[model samples]
Target: MGMTEKQLKSSNKPDKEMPLVQYENVTKKFGDVEVLKGLDLEIKQGEKVALIGPSGSGKTTIIRMLMTLEKPSGGVISLNGEPLWHKKIGDKLVPADEKHLRKLRSDIGMVFQHFNLFPHMTILRNVTEAPIHVLGLSKEEANERAVDMLNKVGLGDKLDAYPEQLSGGQKQRVAIARAVVMHPKVMLFDEVTSALDPELVGEVLQVIRDLAKETDMAMILVTHEMDFARDIADRVVFLHNGQIEEEGHPEDIFETPESERLQGFLSRFLNT
Candidate 1:
């Protein structure tokens, strides 16, 4: 069935409004380089977004900010209509303390390209560690949830395996399972398939496709996979020189790009 059909069937949940995430006039800089320039974006709940652009266009940076890994140099970000960088109290933006950020983070998840699994831990342990340490889930509960997640990602039999025993694609899938175990409302994927071998890329992409189909969690992906982005994303955001050059439905962006920079960038990909 189409996404719209599925959306209609799952309409009983509390009204989670659109624009689950918002960046208003956001900017970021690295000394002499301005990575983000007055960027503004609104991402709705359950929207699957693919951010694409030339290298160093700040696609990854945007994900980092959403993950709270990098603070924005200017402007504000909000998640579920609450300030991500600050807490509002009586009309004033107070500095958001770590505790506050931690609470807010329960609604977000991130999966990076380089599967950041603990080398020493078994796959099951790696998956359960966060729930045990951060969310305070009991060992039994965490294990059950971890096993379910691993199975969901097609890693059920590999629970006893360590990171060293898994292939790159397997490791990436495990990382994805780990992130989703928390049932985050928003999932950030930063070039998750970029490091995979060409032959192995499909396995990882398939896993991600399952995730998109199974959950209502919103996802924002930074990726170079143009075809997949076009097929899956509800909207495609193209960043160039740290700014959003153009953004639209995949057909419009890829088939009839209005921006000169976008056309030039796509041309390079075509030549390759």
Candidate 2:
């Protein structure tokens, strides 16, 4: 892991820069069930990755941890080389406060599978609300940014529409627009397209592909779309039973997976 410019600038020490995101010896448990087992991962800036595996294999868990919606039971995580849970105060690693957590989360955006939009707010409001409330942008400034993002997602004309008024694909796009308007450095998608109708999946994937090509923001997507993972991900990780069974370039994971577990998993999905 390496340090980002933002982290470096915040530190007085020249040698303390850290990786964009790092999980070292991380573990998560739910009573008797261990969801992650001493997992270690390092994602540099601008990497596009897809996580795939069988059901209950901890793909979504990984994404949630990155979003800090779930804390690790053990180990440490860092973003941009700075500790997300531990901050350096006079050379001491002290526990982080809620204020720091909120700031840390501002750099990460998440798109849930359910498209969690405000039904009462119009499409524009749904996208603009966070920027106004969380980022402290003025209403007009937030609206302008929201409209531009909506236009980017090809929903310019639907600003006045409600989430219920739009199709499944449209709602997902608006959800995406809401996520990106904050200009997050890392976007975590937890099966963003899984809930959509078969026909609506393509539109969401196309927008994602466009974003992948146009931005330097890193993306970690948990998806069941095998073909999209094969084609769009710079790297693909396959998890099984709370561990990463295989990880490599898309072609390597798809055409030449190194693990029997991955081979079996893909065979079922590919042949389905």
Candidate 3:
């Protein structure tokens, strides 16, 4: 299905009603180079947005910012209508203190391009460790939750295996299980399947597809997998040179691109 008229019109502005995530006039700069420029985007509750573009188009930066791994140089980012990287103190807004930032960021989870697993920990331990320590769950409780998540990701049988014993695909599945055990309100995926072998990519994608089908978490995917993006995303955002150049339903963006830049970008993949 396509975006409603209201959603399309509000694409450049924050929905006053509060989306699950909102970026208003956000900019990011490093030294003299700007990576994102006045970018405004919103993801509604349960919506899945796929960001696609050429390298350095700032797609990954958006997810990194949402994950609180990077901060915007300008503009305000809000999650659930609350400030994310900044806080309002009386009449002025200031950078959020570490404690405030952590509280706000706890609602979000991210899985990266690499399978950043702890080699020394077993799959079960790797998945349970965060919840046991960060969320204050008891070890038994964490392990139970971890087992269920691993089962969902098709890794239940590998719980006792260390990261080094698993294949790259299996490692990524464990990573997904680890993130899901947090029960995040929003999930950020950065080129999640990019590092897998052609045969192994499907297993990882299937786990993500299951999440999209079974959960209500707002998902933002930064990926080069055009076909997967078309199949899984509710909306496709084509970013160009640090701005959202075009966005629409996957069918519209992939089959009937309205911008030459987007058409050119897709042509590279379509022709292959």
Candidate 4:
């Protein structure tokens, strides 16, 4: 989607009254282990927020629920002000069926810690597969979209390369290109750099930064890159024990954390 002047301007100042994504008192559990506890968060169109904390802090769970990869044990998740996991029938909100879930999942894109590419497919085919099958785009249209996105992510030269032939960073960039080609309204990054070598992280992050600037896509990153988070996120949230310990503007959260939990987390996370 080519951005007109108005669309570009909208990314800079997203409206707040109607949130594009909302999680109200959300909870999740595996057996008796609770992963998310009464979580509440709101994200607006074109906004970028980073979630940071120690291992098992519920950051990934939040996005997984939104992506419809995992259902919440309780509470409601809404996308564009409509219930995500349930549908309204008359006056009651009922559990959503497969059709509802599949349609909602199409509106969001997610990149996991691993590249998750198909070893059997070429780079260009990898990027084009979802659009052709899921979105029902014509083969020519999907190929056109894939080629343009591959060029943007600096993988145009490697179109015929297989996943096993590419470096880790290149694979992740392909993953980004694949997700972005679909024009998702929301993008989820779950520790995208965690599986990469130190030297490879910057290139992937740079691609994300460019996307953040170019599109009005709302982004939520579960990341450990303190500097990257500071530079990219409009807001930073610190989570602990499945709850938000504290949250604020990146500067406030990083520079002068008011809560002991966040302060300790930063000190330990950054120094390690």
Task: Please say which candidate is ahead in lDDT: 1 or 3.
Answer: 3
Residues 65-126, model 1: lDDT tens digits:
98999998888889988999998889999879998899889999999989888999999999
lDDT by residue (tens digit), candidate 3, 33-98: 999998888888888999999999999999999889998999988999888999989978899999
lDDT of 4 by residue, 1-272 (tens): 13233223334454447878888888999899998988878788888999999999999999999999898999999998889999989989999999998888888998889989999999999999999999999999999999999999999999999999999999999999989988899999999999999999999999999999999999999999999999999988789999877877888889999889889988987788
Greater lDDT among 1 and 4 belongs to 4
Deviating ranges (above 4 Å) for candidate 3: 1-7, 10-16
Off by over 4 Å in 1: 1-18
TM-score of each: 0.92, 0.91, 0.94, 0.93
Model 1: ten consecutive residues of lowest lDDT? 1-10
Model 2 bad stretches (over 4 Å):
1-18, 89-94
Number of the candidate with higher lDDT, 2 or 3: 3
lDDT of 4: 0.90
What is the TM-score ranking, best to worst? 3, 4, 1, 2
lDDT of model 1, residue 48: 92
The top-ranked prediction according to TM-score is 3
Winner of 2 and 4 under TM-score: 4
Backbone clashes under 3 angstroms, per model? 1, 6, 0, 0
Clashing pairs in 4: none
